[model samples]
Target: MKVEQIYTKCLAQGAYYIFSEGEAAIIDPLRETQPYIEKLEQDRAKLKYIFETHFHADFVSGHLDLSEKTGASIIYGPTAQPDFEAIIAEDNQIFEIGKIKIKVLHTPGHTLESATYLLIDENGKESAIFSGDTLFLGDVGRPDLAQKATNLTQEELAGMLYDSLYNKIIPLPDDITVYPAHGAGSACGKNMQKETIDTLGNQKRTNYALNQPDKEHFVVAVLDGLTPPPKYFGMNVSMNKKGYKSFHEVIKESYRALSPEQFENLATTESIVILDTREANVFKDGFIPNSINIGLKGSFAPWVGSILVNVQTPILLVCDKDTEREAITRLSRVGFDNVWGFLEDGIQSWKEAGKDLDKINRITAEEFAEEFTPDAVVVDVRKPSEYATEHVEGAYLKPLSDFEEWVKTVDKDKPFYIHCAGGYRSMIAASILKYNGITDFKEVDGGFGQIKKTKVPTTDFVCPSKL
Candidate 1:
């Protein structure tokens, strides 16, 4: 038997592949299906089932397309009402693949349909549990995401999560492996460990959620500091629950290569957005006017999902040469399937055409310190939690996630300086500020990380809870 964790770093999501005796099963797949198809071919296995823990909110699942192509049955836990066909398994129901058995443990907390799949090896010993969002290595999934759909308060969901963990999961074998759906960078859980896999015994001892004193305490702890879910989350969940456009169709429609003039005309004549997915530093040097830079180098998909709320927003890409497909694929992961096209030959084509360009003013942290005044306008685009912990003295907290709303308040005439923890988010902010015609600001090159190292005065670190 072979079990593989296919981890996508950008989304911080994990999908599992289990194979035994020429039969394979996929759990919680991404939007792209070709990779899984290729894996089946390589393993000489026929896919028998696709398992979904819940209707995911982060990225559209590949279950529909994978099942259609492979003739595999898509399975979900009880109480799931998907628009498409799927087998809703009861709690403790079991399915077999080769000599192994997969037992469904209905552990609904993250969502009403959430479940953990228990894998029993050929020797009939419990080998591992694909815990989904029900349990992460260090933390449990946040209860707030499914509140509206379930009509249950986050505290109630948290209580259910505690029950799911304590009654259904904690009694399992200590040595069994625990494979969760997400890790540290994911918005699914606030305090997940960086490690994707851990032993159940280790988790019992180390995971804070698992060690809660009682259900009430667990509910309070789990609901402590959840920021709002990304704007695209609900849209992605809808796409997953209902069916979505085939990835093939999305790719075919999005692969159009537009000439510089065509790209410019589209940007000017239509309501389409220009998304420049280059490196932040390179983007700051120069880019097309009004292009929002959510660079491919950072948490590109989540940032895009947060900033661009509408899934159907038409987008034209200004990517580095050869990264157009990657940008489109990443965008599609979050249900952004309306990519109009990419600028053919990239920004160089526009430069050659002598089209107008825009650049953001940026300065090193040292330079910013030397030029700093006590009352200079400083914008910290880090999250409120980060800001509350410590920030430059007198810096205004305007998180990048809420850039669209807060950006409107920036005065066009006032010169300001903006920074994030590192340069990535600040560059994104710089691009948006320029796009909004507020170009009098300077972005700190290294963000707060470097600013704190300089002579720039920062407030003493304060715990987020206190604020």
Candidate 2:
């Protein structure tokens, strides 16, 4: 028997592949089906089932396309009301794949239809549990995401999560491996560990969510410090539940190459957004005027989804020649399917065509330190928690995730400095600021990481409650 965890670092998501005796099963696949199809061909195994823990809110699932191509039955836990055909397995129901068995453990509260799949090896010993969002290595799924759909308050959902963990999951064998759907950097859980896999016994002892004394404590602890989820979450969930355009179709339509003049015309004539997906350093040097920069090297999809909240927004790409396909694919993963086309031959083509170019003013951390003034306006684009930990004493806390809303209040005439934990998010903020015509600001290169190393005064780490 072989079990593999296919981890995508940018999304911080894991999809599992289990094989035994020439039969294979896939759990929580991504939007593309070609990779899985290739895996099956390589192993010479026939896929029998595709398991979904719940309707995912982060990225569209490939269950429909995978099942259609392979004739595999798509399985979901009880209470799933998908528009497409799927077998809704009952709690404790078991399915066979060659010599191994997969038992369904209905564990809702991440969503009403969440479940964990327990793998019973050929030896009939419980071996591993694919603990979806129901349980993470150091934290459990946030309960607030399902509130509107279920008409349940977050507290009530948190209570249900507590019961799901205590009654359904905690009783599992200590030595059994725990494979979760997401790791750190995912919005699904606030405090997930960086490690993707852990032993159940270790989690029981080390995970704060698993060690809660009672359900009340568990609910309170899990709900604490959760920022609002990205606006694109519900749209992705809807697409997952109701099915979407095939991944192949999205790529085929969006991969069209546009000349510099055509790309410029599209941006001027249509209500389209220009998304530049080069690296932050490359993008800051030169880019299309008024384009938003969410670099492909960083958390590209999530940042795109957060800033461009509407999935249906029309977009034109300005990417490195090699990254155009990847830009479109990643955008489609987050339900951004209205991508029109990409600038052919990248920024060089635009330059050759004598198109107007825009650039951001950036300064080194040491330069910022020398120029620092007690009353100078400084904007910190890191998250709330990071700011609470330690930030420049009087820096304005305008987090990059909430850039759209806070950007409206920027004083275009006033000059300020902006920074994030590192340079990635601050560059994104800088591009957005430039796009909005707020150009009097300079972005601090190396961000707070380098700023903290300088003589600039920063607040000592303060307890969150005191802030």
Per-model tally of clashing residue pairs: 0, 0
Native-vs-model 2 lDDT?
0.93
Runs of candidate 2 with Cα error greater than 4 angstroms are: 462-467
| TM-score of each predicted structure versus truth | 0.97, 0.98
- Residue pairs with backbone atoms closer than 3 Å in model 2 (clashes): none
lDDT of 2 by residue, 132-213 (tens): 9999999999999999999999999999888889998999989999999999999999888899999999999999999888
lDDT (C-alpha, whole model) for all candidates: 0.92, 0.93
What is the alpha-carbon lDDT for the whole of candidate 1? Answer: 0.92
Residue-by-residue lDDT tens digits, candidate 1, 1-467: 99999999999999999999999999999999999999999999999999999999999899999999999999999899999999999999999998899999999889999999999999999989999999999999888988899899988998999999999999999999999999989989888888999999999999888988898889888888788888889999999999999999999999999999899888975668999999988887779999999989779999999988899999999999999999999999999999999999999999999998888888999999999999899999998789989999999998888888988887798889999998999998888888788888899998999999999999998875475
- Which candidate achieves the best TM-score against the true structure? 2
Model 2: weakest 10-residue lDDT segment is 458-467
Error of 1 at 53 (Å): 0.7
